[model samples]
Target chain A: MTKYLAVVSSKAEITALEEFAEQKLAKDDAIVLLSHPYAYGEQARLPGSVLKTSFDYLNREELVEIEGERFRLVPNWYKFDKEFEKSILYKGIQLGELPFGEVDVFFRENLRFLRGLSNAIRKENPDVVLTGKNSVAGSSVRAVAEKQQVKIIRYFELGKQRTFPLFPNLTTRKVSESKKKLSRILSELGRAKRGSKKTVFIASRGYLGNLEQELREKTGFNVFPLELFLLRQSINPLVAVKPFLNKKKLQGLFADAFNKYKQSTGFRENMVFDGVFIGDLFEFKLQQFALLNFPEFVSLVDRIDALFQKKKPCLLVVWSDFVPFEKICVLTAKKYRVPSIAIQHGIFPAPIYKKAGFIRAFAPLTADKTAVWGRAFKKILVDNGVEPGRIVVTGSPKLDSIYNRHFEPEKFKQQLGIGNKKLVVCATQPASSTNNPYQMVEQVLNVVERFPECFLVVKPHPVERTEKYEQLVQRANCNALVLQKTDLHALLNAASAVIIHSSTVGFEAILLERPVIILVRNQKRSGHTGKPRLF
Target chain B: MSSCLASVLQGKKLNELKKEMRKFSLERNICGDGKATERVIKFIENTAKKTGKIELKTK
Candidate 1:
């Protein structure tokens, strides 16, 4: 019998793969590797007996050996390359001098996912690996399949037609010289104006509410975009040479870790979820990633140093110190004795057992000062070990526009076409760093359908696509308007009650004095007793 | 999860919800009262003055 392994990460993938298996792989023995099973919610209906590749398998407390050192797997995955970092020195600056520590948090999850998939593939030993076309997961599959020497087929939907395309033959297009020149011209034009006005560098990825404009109008400080400054600076390859040459040290470190990993029975057995061990899977790729990014990091160091020396800014206002660029700016600002403030972007969650490390990323405020929304946030930060004196309860500058402007609730309701009905705004955020909003959106939709009196308005997170939620709304046949780009404050004004899944908008709803139902996934954290309580 | 939502939707526990949210907000001292922008501007002004980055343009 022919053996097949179907790698499905979402509901759409599972559905397409099932249809394909029924038509083509009906006679063949197939097993399904499901990740984010909550996305689609049906695993039993998949083509074969399902083997979950979801993070559900991760034992967060499990210990693993890397280079003869036993370390906790989940929290310290980024530290696997710690030794490599120690050996590198760029332009008389150490690796730790740059804001590179928290960057690994972004990649750690992907490494774990890739490691899990590699283990599953080795265990299954399928003839062909079938998966749906996903930019993030597909790259991982391509890499794993290429290494395993297995044939891989990707299921793609072009309009209505379902096409199964084979991998390993695609080639990339080169950037034209003229296009590069145009980009450089554009970058030069977009560079922030450096003038006599004392500047306050606003470190942001767009979306800073009214703070940017308000700062420009109300304050003497010129509001400069931190990102624009980074982009405007030309990269110097000479600064990167030291780290590039020291790439050998990284390879040696990974070799030591992998060799030690293979021999450790405790790690091989306990650190594994299914056959996947939370060990070094992408040793070569990670080394390359570090080597490539080190140059950029070194360049950023020089550029930030230039910013401090040239601009002589009074203060640096940033979104968060967790972001690499912002972190670098803040650290550099501190060296120059310039004060930096990190404005809280969202409502901080109360302490949770599993989310301790993740929550700590927000607390103890990375900048010289932290401006929070209220006393509640200050309390949370203080509880999380941040010095209270450094935190200023600045309220939310983003919400200032909402308070200042007038929003007609009836007009917003009319726009939504939910006439005279009580509007219940369901605000959603792309929960988790993995961007798993599907399951949360599905859960909200299911609950909203039961209440006929309430007219549901689904406001997706700014980063999320509206079409996906619209598709979900269409499939459910529910009477809910999925507004991707709408004034959330207006919607909150129209809402009789707000339903939220740990989104900052829920806090806004509270500020507007609208009743809020916080839909927390953790039953214990939701403070559930016999009686129903809105937490 | 849906159970609490059901209670809120049914209008059976809205007062309870509002009360809980109010208590939560009060304890945390949430809400900027529309003065957040003014405060942030003031902070910037004070910082600039303290640092003597630029001479104040007195109106």
Candidate 2:
């Protein structure tokens, strides 16, 4: 009578679980696969056997059903807000009191999934837990399983057959063996086109239209986008021939990287900003994540190094120093004596957390130059021990996109089905600041409710999972526009009033000259309808 | 965020902090036009020339 708690964080794992549900395991071998209830409801194919109940029991008052689905509702602002405060405020005595940014914010989001998983683990009391591939959900499940003293079986797909390991780690043998085989098909090493132009390697998708054009014109450098952006995407078709690279050299580099992991002291030894006790905890977690990811990191660095060796690029420009790929690329570029530059991708790392010591904010270590939004942003780096000379103000290349393009408010209003109504744009972060996602959405809804003539336009953060918000909209049946993959700057420009928690979007609203309101946990606005002030 | 950040997020009583940010932007307005990118290019080219290692095109 084996009880199994299975979790699906991958599409492959989802298909595998669906197949498993069809099979009759030995008697009393009941399985419960816990996932985000709303995640599977409309999008994924999930069976009732997965989880009998849902965490969404929110609205008893004025329930609105959408497409035959009723959303449980609650006022979530305070609860979610408190949860956020707890996760970030643990930084230190002085800096801990202030709000967190970037890496700390990611941990706060992971804490939500961790909470859900911990509850599921305790209630089900399963003998074992199963999940797939590397993701925030997978990491959260692993953390919970370790605390619960439960065994976790991880399955990774390899072409047709799958490798199921009780304690799964992405090891060198599994990685190298695949690349060695890839060398058979891809036999030629990728050659860089050596033009009279100085080459500069870029690691992020060129999202901004004019920035690259301007850089090439001013710098006289051939802007080369990195070949592999992630697991599958190719930034350049030519870089795809990297698989044909000398397998022996890649294997050798990976072996060295693995050895370094075994001998190396964790980030704890290197990082000075994080204060005592929790710093120790962060080091252990981040070190583990880094080690588990070492082989892949080594492979990427080696691949990029191959390009650097051939092309002899003068500069390497990456999105940020935080991401593992970008980190490796920066280090690799340094090894080749190529100056690496990190452009501000999102909000300039907020001043509050950078000075306080957010862990992954390690761009200063490798980047010769760190481009920022303005002098205030430069101060964030300099105050945190980054060299004053290294920080450069680039304003945001992303914002320059807004300056170049324009959207008609009338067209947007018609497209959104809110004809001639004043649009109160309520922007959301990709991750919730609080435990409850709906509470934040509902708070904005409550504001929109005030103006019967004005409908709410919910703009999602770029990195957000909008399913939770989508579910809330369906259940509440609010007259809100959830704009995904739309021109956000135009909407903000056209907005009557803008509402946001502390985020880069809020700053953008201010830059756009829109009336702004900064929502927080405990606050008193004696009168709700006064003119909006700059946040 | 510095101590003044608390004041800014509060949205009011942070006039000094806002002024500081505004002043910072004005002083560092090299981001205007193509000045920031020009600085980056000039810096990279000068370093390359100083090294006398790489032949860079600085048109």
Tally clashing residue pairs in candidate 1: 1
Fnat per predicted structure, each in turn? 0.51, 0.14
RMSD of 2: 14.0
lDDT (Cα, 0-100) at A231 in candidate 1: 38
lDDT of 1 by residue, A1-535 (tens): 6666666555666677667766776555666564632343344365355656534333332111120122134344333344433444444445443433333432445555665567667777777777766434455576566566676555544123223221111112112322454365355435435453777777755445777666765555567767555433323234324344554565465445445544555545544332344334334334443544444565567767776777677888887876556777877776677888888887656344223333434654668888888877777777776888888888878878767888899988887789988887877766443224666677777877876777778888866557777877777746777886678788897887787765778778876778777665544423334222222
Q: DockQ for the candidate 1 complex?
A: 0.32
Q: Report the poorest 10 consecutive residues by lDDT, candidate 2 chain A.
A: A66-75
What is the Cα-based lDDT of residue A475 in candidate 2?
Answer: 63
**Can you give the DockQ of every candidate in the order shown?**
0.32, 0.11
TM-score of each: 0.67, 0.56
- Alpha-carbon local distance difference test for all models: 0.60, 0.51
Docking quality band of candidate 1, CAPRI definitions:
acceptable
